[model samples]
Target: MTTIAPSRPLTAAGYPRGFKWGVSTSSYQIEGGHDADGRLPSIWDTRCRMQGKIANGDTGDVACDHYHRYPEDIALMKGLGLDVYRFSVAWPRVLPKGKGRVNQKGLDFYDRLIDGVLEAGIEPWLCLYHWDLPQALDDLGGWPARDSAGWFADYAALCCQRYGDRVKHWATFNEFAVFTLFGYCIDWSAPGITDREAHLKAIHHVNLAHGMGVDVIRDLVPGAVVGAVHNRQVVWPEKDTDADRRAAALLDAHWNKAFPDPQLLGHYPDLIAESIAPYVKAGDMAQICRRTDWFGLNHYGPIFAKDDPNATWGFHWGAAPDDADKSDIGWPIWPAAFRDELIGLTKTYKLPIYVTENGMGGNDKVDDKGEVNDATRIRYLTLYTDAMKEAIAAGADVRGYYVWSLLDNFEWGTGYQNRFGLVHVDYETQKRTAKASYAWYRDYIKAARAAE
Candidate 1:
């Protein structure tokens, strides 16, 4: 048995007063009943139907049944003493065809969810997109087409008009690099299309859509705080050689700076400028560059890059040193790197930072007494939160920290194989059992609040 230490006070841990603590979840990952409430198919629903596309051939047909049991989930969030709940709204649910007709039932669902969140005294942080693009939009060329910007703006406008009164914190999109590069360039995710040119086009269109979405939300919702979330990574070279160093720099440009730089700095990185120049048009930069209220960062760990002359991008991801501790997903546990990444973002963007999504997937299982002893996850949270406190003390203006998930839902591509949740869910019965980590988090938040 893994022994968990007693909870330490956050003041002693150095977390500042009013440090927002919350949990995050995406729509398709948790809210199954995929065809519920007049909703149409998304790219992910289609992808899961393809042979061997998802692990174990598992589809999110009834993932945790959050669509029907959200009240229970909200109760779970309340129990955790969460200050906020960060969730994404499914595009297909709101607009079956991605445009033209509005689905009142879809809007009504979020209407109730938002009300429940507010009733629980937790702030609602709504992310407009979380990679579940409507299949209707995919049919119309999806993010690769220039028209996607308009489609996305329309969706955002509708959402703002309906939920704006309650939701003040809005994120335009989540992890553009992952969806564009993996979905279009590498063929790992939905609407998978492995083409370099298409990848570049999709990247530009997504950026345009983000800027357009921001404008729509600001125009439609009074007092709306809008921003975009990027899966930021600190790229490190595997060896002290010029080739590896160059590869690391290139990877950093594409993986880290590509989406954010255009949005925040109004220009593309010099390393990738020429390659993406063909798709850039006049006034696009001006449109992409908008004042954001905060910079949402979803960090996991650093990526080790190495020179691979034959690789499509002239860089390949290498394994971390064998001696390093790794998460269940094989991601390295590097808290110092996490701190440095936050400090670096503060130095560059000068916007308030939100650790929007940070957690470790664990090989969690229920014991005979029907409790999950996720001590490893608890440990991961402690170390990472401590690192975040260090970054804040080092001059990073971090306003909040939200763990990746509140419940064990469907993990994309990996299906339900990887679990990253404070509350464990039984796939067979849809039963939620709060793990040791949940108790740890609740106590930590209580201590933090009491200290304040």
Candidate 2:
């Protein structure tokens, strides 16, 4: 056991009064029932069906089975005393065909979900898209086509009409940067396509969709808490050399700043234009620069870069983080990098920020005592929370912190291999076990609530 040491108690006073504390999860990642209740095929549904992509040949076909077990999941959140619950609405469920006629069964699932969340005394922060675009939509060109923006807006309107009354916190999209880069650029995620032109086009359409979703929510729920959830990376150079600096700048522009620059700054970074102009079109920039209420930042590890003479556009490979530890996913657990990323955003955008997604993944296992006390995960949370406090002290207007997930479930391409949850899931039995980190977070919540 990693012993807990005596230290100054972390307090909410480190953040603004009424700062939100919550946990986040996505539908496809947790809500299994992939084929139940008229939930049609999403890109994830189709992708997981493709062999050799996901580990263990895992499909979300029965992921934590949250679809049939959400009441218990709500109880988990309630027990943790979380103030907010961030989750995504599976697009295919809302619009089975991705456009046109609505799927009442799909909408009804969210209706019950929102109601259940409200009854548990936790606010629902809904992400209109979590990259599980309906396979039907992908058949029609997916996010790369202009029509996707309109299709997403229509889906947004349907959701707003149904559950906008109780669910005030609305996130238009979650991590467009990851979707575009991983899905298209890297071809590692669902609906995978490896064309730079397709990637840039998809990125712009998602931005436009976010703006459109914001409009729909604002119109439906005038006092709605609407925002866009972007995964912001911290890009640092391996050295102070001019080449390294330029490489880091390119990485930052594309990975760290691309999504928010247009929405908040009213223009893509000049560097973004230069890097991606071959794929972008006239007037596309203007449409992507639409406004939003607040910015949701999902930060994890930092990247180190150095110039390469042989890479495309003078861009080069980024260094792996040097944090003492890495997650089961091989992602570095450098909490300070997260803090720095937030501070950088605050300085650049001057907007109210929410740490929308943060967590550590581990292959949690039960010990001889029939308990899964994950010391490493607890340490990750403590260090990360301390870093968040540091960011607040540095004058970042971070108003909330939502851990990446509440329970272990499907992890896209990695499937159920990497667990980034406070609660552990017994995939076979569909059982939920609160790991040591869960109790630690519960205690942290108690501390935060008492701090006020």
* Candidate topping TM-score: 1
Residue-wise C-alpha lDDT for candidate 2, range 293-340, written one tens digit per residue: 678988777767888766443555565745546766677778878778
Model 2 lDDT, full chain set? 0.81
Off by over 4 Å in 2: 1-13, 237-247, 275-286, 305-324
Q: Estimate each model's TM-score.
A: 0.96, 0.92
TM-score, prediction 1: 0.96
Q: Clashing residue pairs in candidate 1, if any?
A: none
Residue pairs with backbone overlap in model 2: 304-319
